[model samples]
Target chain A: MKNRLKVLRAERDWTQAELAAALKVSRQTINAIEKGKFDPSLPLAFKAARLFELSIEDIFQDEVTP
Target chain B: MKERTTEAGDFTACNVKNNVRLLSWVFAWVVTLVLADKAELYEWHSSAFISIAAIVINAAIGLGVIVVFMRHLKGLDELQRKIQLDALALSMGVGLVGSFTYSLLVTAKFVIDAEVTDIILLMTLTYVVGVIVGQVRYR
Candidate 1:
């Protein structure tokens, strides 16, 4: 999975720590999601979507579409 | 004054307490083992009460470690918890197979001087490896 988390964060001029605090997760988790090293769980993804006021599909995309 | 974070990667306030508790658990294990060894070697068994006290102390320390370990596991995030669960499962499987193999060899009259401590050490090593493998797979 790929996500536009970095772009969204950058648009808001938010640091990873700031975003993580809002999302109730550690900064490492945000970094991992941004780097594509880790995929967030559904609840976390929903939290991120709610935080950014965007749909999950708008934030995340499948790397290999069916 | 600012709160200090230990090198264990616990960022939350609750995690700080958990880290300190974990450190105390390790300290207690070392102290209990040393005391137990001394009790066994020296003449601490001169009194039945003293002997029983030592055994009780050892058991209490072991139980404390287990309790603290479970609490620490409960505090992990979902992904980390998954990794730990998988690691524990793999380690347990390896430990059982290794112990069963050694027991069979012992039954076959093979002269193996392995003790329970050796099995415990092997299991610990296996858990460490399992955790590393899980982390690598996720990373």
Candidate 2:
């Protein structure tokens, strides 16, 4: 999955640690998600969407073509 | 104040508490295990009676370690929990394999003085390596 997490966090001027704190996850987790090494779970994706005030599709895009 | 994160990656506040409790339980289990071994070896008190008592206490503490570990897993964030679960699965597989090989060695008239502790140590080492690998892989 591809996500705009890094771009969004940068737009908000939030460090990875700050963003992690907001999401109640480790900075490593946020880093992993941004790097596409790990995909966020549904609840975590929802949390991120809520934090960013956007829909999940707005933040995350499926890399697979339908 | 700089936030403290003692976990392999970075610890959350609840994770710190979970880590402490898990460590405390593990330490207790180790201490009780040593005490039980010593009691059995030295024939302390009423020999069999003291040995049984120590073994019982040690077993109960071992159970505590298991409970604490389960809670620790539950408290971890998703990625951390996944890493831990993967490491545990690997460790368990290796432990079972080691046990079966040891049994074979014993039945084959091999005079090796290998103990169950050896297998346990191997499993622990494997789990540590597995966690480290997972962390690095995700990094």
Candidate 3:
């Protein structure tokens, strides 16, 4: 999965830690998500969407597996 | 970005503190054991009392360390909690299997006396493995 978390966070002038605090997650988690090192769970994705005032589809996209 | 850096720094500091506490406890215990052994404390008439006192002291120290560590962990976010839980579960599973295998080996006379140090080492290894598993899985 790919997400516009970095862009959204940047637009909001929010650091990963701030976003993580709002979402009740660790800064490392936010960093990993932004770096595409880890994929967030469905609930986490929804939380991020809600925080950004955007739909989940707008924030994240699924990669098709061949 | 600043906040992220601070949080990351805090996490690193906390990890370092935890390692220090663990190392200190191990060192204290080893030193006490060695001193007692050399002094022939076990052969003393009040050896039982001294042994009991030592056990109590160790327990208190261990409890204090665990409590401090847990208090720090309590403030963790959802992702942190999930990672911790996953790690703990892995540790428990691995520790159980390792202990059971050791017990089986003992029963079959395949191994000699298994000391407390052996069990402690096993548990430590379990935690190390758990951390490794969590890092790999979450990454």
Candidate 4:
């Protein structure tokens, strides 16, 4: 999956650590997600969506899907 | 946005508390094990009762370590938990494989004077390596 997490965080002037603090996760997790090396679980994806005030699809796009 | 209620990163207060508990339990377990082994080796207690007591105490501390470790894992973030679980699985695999292979070698008269502690040390080293690899990969 590809995500706009980096772009979104940049737009909000939020560092990875700040975003991770908000999500109750480690900064490494956020970095891995942003780098497309790791995929978030459902609850974490939902949490990110809620934080961004957007749907999951709006944030993460499946590379092979419509 | 939900208000940030605590400090950033993975070291939350609950996590720190559980870590401390786990560390203490592990320390106690190691101390009890060493004391029991030394007492047995030196014949410090001729009574079976003292040996039994040592075993019981050691087991209780080991149980405490397991419980505290489980709680700590539960409180960790998903990625951390996954890494831990993976490392645990790898360690378990190493333990089983190493023990059986050693047993086979001993039975075949290819090796001699082996102990369970050696296998345990191997498993521990494998677990540490697994955790380090997982952390580095995710980082």
- Give me the candidate number with maximum TM-score: 4
Cα deviation in Å at residue B121, candidate 4? 0.8
State the TM-score for model 2.
0.89
Judging by lDDT, tell me the better candidate of 1 and 3.
1
Report the error of model 3 at residue B50, Å: 2.4
| Per-residue error (Å), model 4, residue B26 | 0.3
Q: Estimate TM-scores for all models.
A: 0.79, 0.89, 0.65, 0.93
Q: Candidate 4 has which clashing residue pairs, if any?
A: none
Specify the CAPRI tier of model 2.
acceptable
Q: Please, what are the lDDT tens digits per residue for candidate 1 over residues A9-54? A: 9998877777766765566667778999888898989988988899
Better of 1 and 4 by lDDT: 4
Least accurate 10 contiguous residues by lDDT in model 4 chain B: B1-10
Question: Candidate 4's residue-wise lDDT over B15-91, tens digit each?
Answer: 77888888898999999999999999999979999999999999999998888888889989898888899999999
- By lDDT, the better pick of 2 and 3 is 2
Give the residue spans of candidate 1 off by over 4 A: A62-64, B1-10, B135-139
User: Which pairs clash (backbone N, Cα, C closer than 3 Å) in model 1?
Assistant: none
- Residue-level error in angstroms, candidate 1, position B93: 1.9
* lDDT (10s digit) by residue, model 3, range B1-139: 4565566667657666766766676676666666556545546545677767766766676676677557545655555666777777777776778788888999899989776568668777777777777767665
DockQ for each candidate? 0.30, 0.41, 0.31, 0.55
Tell me the spans in candidate 3 whose CA falls farther than 4 Å from its real position.
A10-26, A35-66, B1-47, B136-139
Better of 3 and 4 by lDDT: 4
Question: Candidate 1 vs candidate 3: which has greater TM-score?
Answer: 1
Q: Please tell me which predicted candidate would have the highest lDDT against the true structure.
A: 4
**Every model: Cα RMSD to truth:** 4.1, 3.5, 4.6, 1.9
